[model samples]
Target: MQEKLNQFNLLKKKSEKQVAIGLVIIVVATLLFLTMSSVGSEELGQMLGIIVGLIGGIVALVGAAGFSKVKRTFKTEVLSAFFSEVIPGTDYIPDRGLAPVEVYATEFLKRADRFHSEDLLKGKLDDVDFLSSDVRLEERHVQHTKNGTRVYYVPYFVGRVFRFTFNKEFEGYLQVLEAGSPLTNRDFQKVELESIDFNKKFKTYATTELSAFYVLTPDIMEAIFELEKRNPGRIGLSFAGENLYIAINNNKNTFEIKMFRTIDNAMMEGFKNDLMVIKDFIHTLKLNTKIFKRK
Candidate 1:
C-alpha cells in the first residue's frame, strides 16, 4: 500500500487520465441518449451531441496545458536555483531580449559612442565612489606571462576582499554595462559561461559550475582573477572531465565553484609529485585559442 501511494505521488498531477475518462463517459452518454430519444427529435439530438463534444475537447485541452506548464516550471526553477548556488559574487542577471545580433550591435554602438565622446567627457572618475570595500575579492595570485599570455590563478576559495584594476578600456565601457564581466574587450563575446544540470545527469543534491577561458583574444586573458577570500584555507580543487577540465570549489564559505579547461599534457608527468616535493603546485593555467570558437 505504501509503494502504491508512492507511485501515485510520482504521477503528474495534471495527467490526461481524467480527461480521457470524461471523454469515454461523454461518448457512452451520447450513444445511449441518442438511441433512447424519439425519431422526431433529430435537431435536439444534434445539439446535445455538439455540446458534449465541445465540452470533452475543452477538458482535454485544459488538462494537457496544465501538465505542460508544470513540467516547464519544474525544470526552470531547478536550474535557476542550481546556478544561483554555484556562482560566487554572482546573481541571476537574465539576458532577456538579448540576441547575438542585438548584443553585437549594442557592443558596437558602445564602442563607437565612447570613441566619439572621449573628448566631450573630461575626467569623470572622481564622480564615482567605486565603493572599494563593497567590492569583494577572493583569491589573489600572479602568473608569469608566457607566449604573450597572462594567466591569473586563484585557489578554490571564495573571498570578499580582493582588488584588481583594469585598463581605462574596461573602466570606460564595462563600467557602463549592467553586468560586469571578467573578460577583456575582444574576447568578451567568447567568454564561456556554463551551468550543469545535476538532476538531469544524476540524483544528487549538488549542481556544478563550469566556466572556461581560451586564448582567442588578448582580452580573454584578463578573465583570470586573483582571489583573496575570508577563508583561504578552505579553497580546494576537484578533478572532473579528466585533463580537459579542472574545478575549484569554495565549500567553507559559500557554495561556489569555477571550472576551467586545461591544455592536454601541459604538465610534466611527475609535475604533481615534483610540486609536492618542492611544496608547490602548478601556479599557472594555459589554454589553446581554438577552443573558444563558437560551438
Candidate 2:
C-alpha cells in the first residue's frame, strides 16, 4: 500500500508539473501578445500570438487530461492493493457495479435515466454477507439557450450503497431517509420519532408502524446518529426482507485521488480505513443477532 502511495505521489507531482507547464505557456503567450504592439510588430505579433495561444491551449488540455488519467489509474492501482493486502477474499471491481435491476429493486433510492456505478466490493466476514459500490443516479435535463438545447444530467444520488444480509429477517418495509432527501415510496406512511434532533435529521417511513418502532429503538437511533457523525454524507437505512440496505449520500467519488490535495495523516487514515464502515455497522446495529418478534 505504501509503495502504491509512493507511486501515486510521484505521478501526482508529474501531472501537476505538466499542468503548470501548460499554464505558463498560455501566460507567456498572452504577455507576448500584449507587448507585441508596443514593440512595433502588431501584425506579426497577432499571427504569432494566435499560434502560440492555440499551442498553449492544446498543451493545457493535454495536461488536464493527464491529471484525469492519473486519478483513474490511482484508484484502480492503489485501491486494488488495499483490497488485496488489507481485506483478503474481498473482490474489488474498479469499473463495474451493481446492475440497474439490483439498484432499482432496493426501492429506497430515486430512479434516474442515467445511472453509473463502480468500485464494487463484496465479501463475507464473521458470517455477515456484504456487498457495496459507489453509485450515481442522474436524470436528464435540457437547458434551452441561444446556443440551442443543451443536455444536462441532474444527479439524484451520488454516494456509496451497501447491502448486508444476515440470518435475521425483517417484516414489512421500514425506510429511514435523511431529512430533505427525495426518495420515497407510496406504500410507506411517514412517521415521526420521539427525538426532535433525530426527527429533524431523518424522516422515517414504514409499512408497519410497530416494526418501525421496534427496529428503530432509542439506542439504535443513537447508534445511527454516531454513524452519521463518522460518515461525510446523508444516511439512508432500510429494513426489507432479510437484508439491510444503507445508502450514504456524500456526493463524492470516494476512491479517486485528488492531485491538488496533499496526502496527509487524516487523508491517509481515511484511505487505510477503507470498508471499516461495514464493521462499524455490524457492531453498532448488532446485525449479527438482530432477531425480530411480535410486540
Candidate 3:
C-alpha cells in the first residue's frame, strides 16, 4: 500500500506541475494579448506578440488537456489497485457506470439536465449480483444579465447509487424518498406507513397505496431506518421488478483521490469504510434472503 501511495503521489505531483506550468503560460499570454498584442500602427512587436500570445495560449491549453488525460489514467491505476487490496471479491472499473436507464427508472429523484457517474464497483456477495457508482446529477440554468448570458449547472444529487438483484420479482413499482428536510422539496402522493417515525423520515410514492404497503413491509421499513441510522445520509430507494436501487445523497465523491490531501492509513481506512457501504447495505437490507412471491 505504501508503495502504491508513493506511486500515486509521484504521478500526481507531475500532473500538477504540468497543469500549473500550462496555466502560467496561458495567463502570461492573456496579459500579452490584451495589453500588447496590438498597437495603433502595425509594428513588429505588435504582430510578434499577438502571434506568440494567442497561439501560445492555445497550445498551452492543449498541453493542459494532455495532463488531464494523464490524471485520468493515474486515477484508474491507483483506484484499481486500492480496491483490489482492500475489498475482496470486488472489481473496480473506473470507466464504467450505472446504466442511465435504471437510474431514471428509479423515479425517486428527478432526472437532471446533465449526469455524471464514475468509479463503478461490480461484484457478487452472498450469491447476489450488485453494482454501484458515484453519481452527480446537475440541472442547467441560464441567467441573462447586463454582462451577458451566463450558464451554470446546479447539482440536484451528488452522491453514490447502488443496484442489487433481489430474490423475488414484483411487478409494481414503489419509491421512497427522503422527506421533511429543509434542503429537499420533492412532492408526490405520500404513502404513510404504520410507523410514524418512518413516515416522518421518508416519503413513499407508488403506483397505488396497496403497492407501497406490499413492498414496504414492516421489516423493510425498519431496515430502511436502520440503514439511515448507520449511514446517516439522505437516501432514496426504489423497488421495481426484481431489482432494488439505493441512492445515497451524501454530497461526496468516492474512490477519487485529491491532489492535495495527505494519504495515510487513517484515510485509507475511511475509504475502506465507504466501500463497506456496499456490504453494509446488503447485510442491513437482507437483500440476499428469499422473499415471498406475489400470489
- The best candidate by TM-score is 2
Mark the regions of model 2 whose C-alpha exceeds 4 Å error after superposition.
Answer: 37-46, 194-197, 261-266, 290-295
- In every candidate, how many clashes are there? 11, 0, 0
User: Could you give candidate 1's per-residue lDDT for residues 188-215 as a string of tens digits?
Assistant: 3222232222112111110122122111
Tens digits of per-residue lDDT, candidate 2, 51-94, equal 88888888878877988888778767666766656667777787
Question: Against the unseen true structure, what C-alpha lDDT does each candidate score?
Answer: 0.28, 0.79, 0.75
RMSD of each: 22.6, 3.3, 4.7
Model 1 per-residue lDDT at 272: 25
Q: How are the candidates ranked when ordered by TM-score, highest leading?
A: 2, 3, 1
Model 3 per-residue lDDT tens digits across residues 173-238: 777878843222234456788889988888787767887887777988998988888776788888
Ranking by lDDT: 2, 3, 1
Q: Let me know the TM-score candidate 3 reaches against the reference structure.
A: 0.77
Instruction: Look at candidate 1 and tell me the lDDT of residue 237.
Output: 21
Q: TM-scores of all models?
A: 0.26, 0.85, 0.77
